[model samples]
Target: MATKLLTFVIFLAGVLPAADAAIDIGKVLGEHREFSLFSSLLSSTGVARATNSREAVTVLAPNNTAVVAALRGVPRGADTRALLSDVLSLHVILEYIDADKLELLAEGRSGDGTRVTTLLQANGKAQGRYAGFVHISVGEEEYDRITFTSGAIGSPWNATFEKAIAQLPPSVSVLQVSGFIFPPGVIPPQPRARQTSMPPAPSPAPGPMAHPPRQPLLPAPAPAPPRPTPATPNLTNTPPPSGNVIPIPIPSVDGGMNATLPSAAGHRVASSWGVAGLLFGLVVCLIWSL
Candidate 1:
């Protein structure tokens, strides 16, 4: 019995180290359907193999939706493969950070948050205080919320923690993030083209008539007759004829006799002396009769 126990113990010691030394990221991601595209990217970019050799590492895997969104407008070619490799490298961290460790770091850090180095630093693609670094922090208002922000200057890309995918402890920890965490100078996703119908063309305006209708004609108005003018009398000084003169009666005043005047002249002419003489004769006759 002592010989059999010694052989079993030796076998167990050899198997445990090999199991803990390497992790298959593709297998872990393949289990989840939502990470199918992400898993493919890791395989194609060779990020999965690179990650397996690392001692301790954390991966922020975006869902298929996020992968699709980030790939929008990106052309396919050798250059594209290199770009994707660099991007996936940035998503990997050199140290294992599980949900518990992330919460503890959040609680311990100030408002500036904690910075962690990524695989980019190991590959020598980037070097600096912020290059190949990502900032992880908890939301100020919502303590349960966590965010991953790009360390690149002036980069607006950020992703929120969705849920823990798998945790192998000291070896590997994969977490699902809301979207892609892009660094500076990386082109963002383009919007889908909308299918819209064109508006109908306006009807052509009516053209002027070729031949216009004629109007009916009416008779012209008659001219008015001329008015008659009166004749003016002649004003000449001429003597009257001798035989043609006719007498006209002139009435006297104050109960005296009426005197006779010559007609045929335009006007009557009784002298002043004749009028006085007639009045005087009447006075004499009146005295005699009394």
Candidate 2:
């Protein structure tokens, strides 16, 4: 039948693109927060979880007085909940991208500027330093800040800024990127190490002029000494001289070939060393017939 209905139409075209990616993450969490927790932390610091799930997002949020003055030089307790969860996971960003994808990621990017990456991250690193510069003159709603540099030396990324205030959300706002667009030794881009892709160079084994029979190289001579040969004697007392034949050898095809035939109840089972010496001779003949 048309190859099992073309393998059930290639398994329903691979289950309709994961059922349309679970209905677009339930219509992007019921329409926007832009993947909130500052954009589901740039896809939880793994980077662009499907580019912040499309549809348009331009978060410049950082309000509760810029998240309480970006956590006033942290230090309240338990190491201020791991240094404000790595300075609020490097300020989240995966892209639902608005403000024209932050001016095409800031045109030709210059120094003291570029380093935008977030999905926040911890121990294995990367929880902040997403300051790729895009400060469009503060208020009047043109806010878009992504700045960096806060509490440095031996990295104390305020524990992703107290895990971005315990993963905010009640409608999203978080502020405090103070004095109009960051610069005091600008910080935020830490979650670094990720590179990975390199495994593709193994296809050269076909040469010998693509198979023919060319095996020639010979030049290598001299080195032959040890001589002496002449001793044959003990003929086993000269015997056996009537009807001598001895031939029987046929085995080959890589020896003992069978072409499938083993199961006669797996040759009557019993061999873990003959069933442990027949259960230790039936427990020593049941303790000598008790």
Candidate 3:
């Protein structure tokens, strides 16, 4: 009857989240020098308050050295505070799980993983829903090795379950791990580029009708203007001078006929005409004197 009663007590202890007195995970971890790093960070991130909840919890504790190693790669500064806080939350499991229970859970789950809720309800991509879910599984080569981290956020960043550090019945339990469980938001390092071979593209066929490379068109030279031809008198169509031609006076420029400048030939012709009239007048006077 005592054995049965003890079993029942143990079962109740596993079922409970945390007793009111057992909630201070910080104080418990603070007592141990090895867990001091995790303890301080838990308090800073307020994830330690998760142990004070009415729900049961399991903490996968990484030692101070392990904590330092995990954080070593992370560049230090205030910007990483929220990231560190979320990372700290990843160490915590909301459900009460002893080392033996975690071992049993590892069985039959060869391919698919199991999810464990953490203290960070707001740490994932979604709002209000719990984001930090650690994927639990047993290592293949090492049967005993249990891995805890999420596939939703997979990586070179992973935390391995080492051993159970401490256990408090009906409340909080602490397990030591090899590394820190990285959160979902942090980006991972880029993978190296791989060399690959591909067939080259075929060149365009060069032949008649194929389009040539475009060249800018120079502006066309301005057209040359037509040259002016001088006016020539039509000598073939001109009439010989008659007696009536002498009496016809040259018209004024106002009469609408354009004035033409006489050449040297015209001046010689006028002088010759005046001399012939004078000789004819003298002959007529001598005839009249006889």
Best by TM-score: 1
TM-score of each: 0.58, 0.19, 0.51
Task: Point out where model 1 deviates above 4 Å.
Answer: 1-21, 140-144, 189-290
Cα lDDT for residue 212, model 2? 70
Please provide, for model 1 over 48-144, each residue's C-alpha lDDT reduced to its tens digit, 9 standing for 90 to 100: 8888778888999999998888777566778778777877888999999988898776555565568788887688876455767887877656667
Worst 10 residues of 2 by lDDT: 158-167
In what order do the candidates fall by TM-score, top score first? 1, 3, 2
Model 2, span 91-113: residue lDDT tens: 43323444333344433254222
Regions more than 4 Å wrong, model 3: 1-22, 73-76, 108-111, 122-131, 151-157, 188-290
Q: How many clashes would you count in candidate 2?
A: 41
Instruction: RMSD for all candidates, in order, please.
Output: 15.0, 40.8, 20.4
Provide the overall lDDT of each model, using Cα atoms, as 2-decimal numbers.
0.77, 0.38, 0.68
